[model samples]
Target: MDERFNVELEQLLQDRGRDFLSLSGVCKVMPSALRARLGLKSNSRVGEVQKALQPHMGRNLEIRKAGRSLCLVRRGEKDEMLLRSVQARPGKSPKTLRNSLPFTAAEFLRLTNSLLKEGRLRVELNARCEPLLFAVSPEGPPTLQPQPLALAPVPDAEAEKAVLRAAFQELEQGRIFVRICDLRRRLGWSREAFDSALARLRRERTVQLHSGDVSAMTQEELQDSFVDENGFRMLSLTWTEAR
Candidate 1:
């Protein structure tokens, strides 16, 4: 149905502390109706019901049926919601304080990396490598304060080569634009050094500037290029138009 209805249904299940909600109970429908909600065809097998609920159930939920009763187990609903809030509004924001958004399992575990230091966001390989959930532990969030990144150290030649290879690959694909600043950060190079290297590459005709609509660019654009010792450097390498 509509997104609102879906959200309402999910919230309703959580608020009610339900572990298992039968399709019949949700819509006053029959076993066949439940099969439809579970995204099953008329000839679909009986086991498809679990697959349908897997996405919304997160990690703390379990659905099981014993005899005639279909039950659910939802553990730590409040904590999981809190973690989701942090992930939606990461970086400096009001969300950094208590209770703006509910944290998802992943964000909560990340915030408190102590007890769950070994835990990580769960990656679902079958679902396009999408993130599914976060692991939790008995301990709480870590106390490490974030730090601003200053110039750490110059990247060695091996790292620089890796950066150039990746950038060149992106440039050739022409599907996704690669910015110079991204290359610099990925390589841990200073602005001047990055620009100088890029300029040298441009002179070799290995890359091209696909766009220059400065005002239309986003924050992702601001870090696109770098300044060299001689001031801002221009891309020297370029792909020639086919004759």
Candidate 2:
């Protein structure tokens, strides 16, 4: 009887230890800071971190790669509530959605994009020419607003160029070659609009598209593009040489 009790106690302690580790790992903290606190080696790979976090996977915790680092985020009760709220209304601007929820802009974007990639969410343009998000469901009615609500005039060519330019500048600031899907999300452009703008840029030699390889492409080859299974199309904006 004493041996059994000791064995049960040992199991209980191990379970408690795992719970503590998982809770600490999921704190809303910076990756580097969390690594330091957890005493993880500085050169730990993402896969290593994920292996260390295996016990926490799918238990209201998720790991995400943010830039070059991995971060832990919670998908707990609050996140479920947020999803339900968005599903109920089914078409809100990102700003509006952010305001309605407790997430920061970055967090909102991350969560929404994840859902979109998973086909749990969809996006459409509203009458105001702003992107709105909706939840996906088989039995539900189409999420788009009726034709009556699309009374706002379409933006002119200059307006479209301005928007595209703004998006390009933002990408330049990040100093990273952006994926086409991510760029479209950043610019809030529908698929049609994004493709049209990109074709125009290619024609003008203002941007270069790449495949998995990041090497510079000649102007003639910019028109050819491919999207990977994960929906990434490497893109870089080009600058004219000043003499």
Candidate 3:
């Protein structure tokens, strides 16, 4: 039964081409004859199906498990597809990649970040500061660098207060918490401008910044924020009522 299943599965792979076949899809075909010939149990769990298919695991095919389902692809198929997709549409967002590929959000991030670390990919920020991924050709793509801020502009004190007040009001009205990046993007301010304004707010006891890891913190512990290696300053904000 296992050998017969392997042969049929290989045929199905050829039929599907680059698309993935879910375990359930492999178990039951539209034609009852084919389904019975495959000899897969309709009630078989993914583990059982995987065990039955284990003999086919080799250079010709690859299996990926993504959250309760299995995705099978021809060996060396997806990398070429992913590279072509990134090259054809540079500046594609992580969400777009997830939609295009058979990967979940976590899987996409892990794989792409691995590629990025391997220098097979590059990243740039879109106008909204969302990260976009691009493929690196042999000759390499021209660097898309952020404009240098020679002297960071000082944020207006009154304007800073206003922004903090608005952030507090917005947080209270909805999420009860906000990320620093989201707030800066909403205000249309550069990182430097936002950080400076945020500093003043912190000093005046109007708001407190937190390390991204620390969801909740007392005002006294607010000075402990750290920048991530990617230069992203991820912090949560809490509004403090004036004494």
Candidate 4:
């Protein structure tokens, strides 16, 4: 049973970007549409999940018990732990991320500034005009500062469109929907400019944005999502005709 649980848990973790996950999905065992494939029924008294997660704790993951809903978050350096959280579930606001981390507000702020300066982390706004953090590099510290977000000149309307198209062309590679984060990096635009342009195009219905399985995405891919004021998240975009 332990071996089986480990196998199932490992795959589930991989599918979820090896970052964070909820036991609600995998807490039950047995054939049912309602249950996640990785089954570990803690209620059964036969297969308690905490015991299953025991072997993995302190190695690569941590068991974060929040109320009755048990969550598994990545375990690593303080920097990496925070990065994974922001990358996986940025939530609706910056405060959301801060609330979730194991740091005080002041400590979180200091860490945020350090990561931002090192270019391993990033901040951007969504359609709802909320600020969120993203991990530019998932692992170690970034080797150099990325100046494009800070140094790039804001493009004019026509220029923004042209560059956006160019970015899409470069990143899509024939996919119907391309990851928004990749496009943003390719365009080398500041977060403000990128979000504004994307919002404009979305509002005009020139581009259709879509969300995907967060577990199946990398940290950078997860953070590059486009969320709106209603807290709706869009991770990729597709377009047919636009001005």
* TM-scores for every predicted model: 0.28, 0.35, 0.38, 0.51
Best-matching candidate per TM-score: 4
What's the C-alpha lDDT at position 215 in model 1? Answer: 32
TM-score of 1: 0.28
Compared with the true structure, the alpha-carbon lDDT of candidate 1 equals 0.41
Candidate with the greatest lDDT versus the true structure: 4
Steric clash pairs (candidate 3): none
* Error of model 3, residue 37, in angstroms: 3.3
Q: lDDT at 58 for candidate 3?
A: 59
lDDT of 3 by residue, 64-142 (tens): 6534457554555555656655664455566645664556677567777777887888887644666767778677655
Off by over 4 Å in 3: 1-4, 28-34, 41-44, 84-92, 95-124, 134-243
- For residues 1-243, what per-residue lDDT tens digits would candidate 1 score against the true structure? 344334544665666444334432433222455446557654433345445554555455545442233333344654444344333222222222232223344554455443224352221221122222233322665221221122222356545544566544554455445555444444433345556666665555555544343332222224335444456533223343221
Q: Write the per-residue lDDT of candidate 2 for residues 1-243, one digit (tens) a residue.
A: 234322332333244332112222232222455455444554555566566554434544455443233444344554454566566445546665565454556777788888778777777775556777777776776553322222232368656665666555656665645555435545544445567767666666666666564333321122223343457755544432120
Order candidates by lDDT, high to low: 4, 3, 2, 1
Specify the poorest-scoring 10-residue window by lDDT in model 2.
18-27
